[model samples]
Target: MGKPMVLFLCTGNSARSQMAEAFLRQHAGNKYDAHSAGLNPQGVHPLTIQVMKETGIDISGHQSKSLNQYLGKTSPKWVIFGCEKAEESCPHVWPFSLQSESWNLEDPVDFTGDELEQLMKFRFVRDQIEARILDWITENRIDSETEN
Candidate 1:
């Protein structure tokens, strides 16, 4: 069987969800496939690319996509919303999803600050997403191993 799939969603696919997708791919790509989309597609943010690059993961090529891209084509094992807007906007029932959750992560785009401070905010969110992904990977490791 193929690895399980994880989809991260947010209002804009520019930051939080993007970061989560890359982190999951980096931390558990062998055990799961990580993908992300937006309720309203906004091109990946420049700061998002910069912050991720700081961690050595280049998401410069990652495109912000609409959830429609996956609605009928893919059924993720987990559908995770990175923000409250997405959680509220998405359908309550993902018929094919095994689980659904909202992370309610802070949107770095909403943070108002100088360049360095803004970058710090982006990094902060990025790190938070990474930590959560790591914990999730650990929590699911046993299940993933058994399934494989």
Candidate 2:
């Protein structure tokens, strides 16, 4: 058996995709491997780091990346679209090995104003995404037969 591969995607690869990547990695343990990318890469957002660290998930080392980087790579078993733009921009050329889903997360990059408000929203979205991933993983709970 092999590790299940999961890919999280977004337009900017800065916030939502990054969060999904961390959540899956932390929650899935050794049962899976995960990565994240975007249609148009930008540096990882600073706030993304702050909020995840609140829950002790350090994503500060993650850098934003483009989807083209994975074009020729092996397709993942699970591909999750974490942003609207990435959902719209995903190429239809992926091989049949992929099972995909979209969370349609609101990009926190658009969030502005007070620092307190921003942190609140960031944590809110992060927790929501984390809960969703936890539910999905639990619903598909793996047995020993599914282990590598």
Candidate 3:
């Protein structure tokens, strides 16, 4: 059988959800198939690529996808909303029978600051997602070979 799937959702497929997807894949790619999508698909943010690169994970090839894409497809093992908007707006009856949860992370794109400050915010958000992924891996005993 193929690896179990984990889906991350957010307002835009640009930041938080993207970061979480990348972090999970890097840490537990061998154990789970990580994917991400948005309520309103906005392309992946450039800062996301930069911040992920800092952690040695390249999300540059990741694309913005809408939640509808997975509507009639395979059900993920876990569907995690990375932002409140996604959690609240998600459909009551999804096609999948997966477990769902919310992360309630602040949107880094909503941060208003200078270039350097904005970059720092992105990095902070990226680190936060990575930390959460690591915690989840340990708690679930994923047996990930990647070093955090």
Candidate 4:
């Protein structure tokens, strides 16, 4: 059997959800299978790749996916909504026996600013997602000693 799966959901698979997926995979790849998708699928944002690369985790190859792809498939152990839009829009009754939670993160892509300011916003959100994933791993006791 493989590690249990955890899916992160968001309005767009471009930033927050993608960051969560990468961070979780980096921190606990041996304990959980991290996946992410959006309700309205949009391609992964360039800023997402740039910010993640700064942290030494390259997400350049990651692709945005839709929630529909997993509808009839094996259910994930945990379904985490990375933003309010996803949590509010998601079905109230999930088909799988899974735990769900909302993180209510701001969308970095929605920010309006200069190039440097925009990059900073992306970095901030990226760091927050990484911290949250690390916290989740520790709180869940999901084998924190795993290597990348």
Candidate 1 Cα misplacement greater than 4 A, ranges: none
What are the runs in model 4 whose C-alpha is more than 4 Å off? Answer: 142-148
C-alpha RMSD between model 4 and the true structure: 3.0
Summarize candidate 4's per-residue lDDT along 41-117 as a digit string, tens digits: 88999999999999999999999999888776867878899888888887563667368888989999999999999
What value does the lDDT take at residue 73 in candidate 3?
Answer: 82
Candidate number achieving the greatest lDDT relative to the actual structure: 1
Assess each prediction's global lDDT (C-alpha) against the native: 0.91, 0.82, 0.84, 0.86
Q: What does candidate 2's lDDT look like per residue over 1-148, in tens digits?
A: 6787788889888888898889888988567778889888888888889999988999888899888888878677778888767777774636575577878888888888698888888888899889988987886566412655
> After TM-score superposition, what is the CA distance of residue 148 in candidate 4 from its true location, in Å?
19
Cα shift from native, residue 42, model 4 (Å): 1.2
lDDT of 3 by residue, 28-93 (tens): 887888999999999999999998998898878899999988877867878888988888887453
Q: Where does candidate 2 stray beyond 4 Å?
A: 91-93, 143-147
Residue 104's lDDT in candidate 2: 88
Superposition error at 135 for model 2 (Å): 0.8
lDDT of 1 by residue, 1-148 (tens): 8999899999989999999999999888999989999999989999999999999999999999999898879888899999888988876637779888878999999999999999999999999999999998998888789768
Better of 2 and 4 by lDDT: 4
Q: Which of candidates 1 and 3 is the stronger one according to lDDT?
A: 1
Query: What TM-score, over all chains together, does every model reach?
Result: 0.96, 0.91, 0.91, 0.92
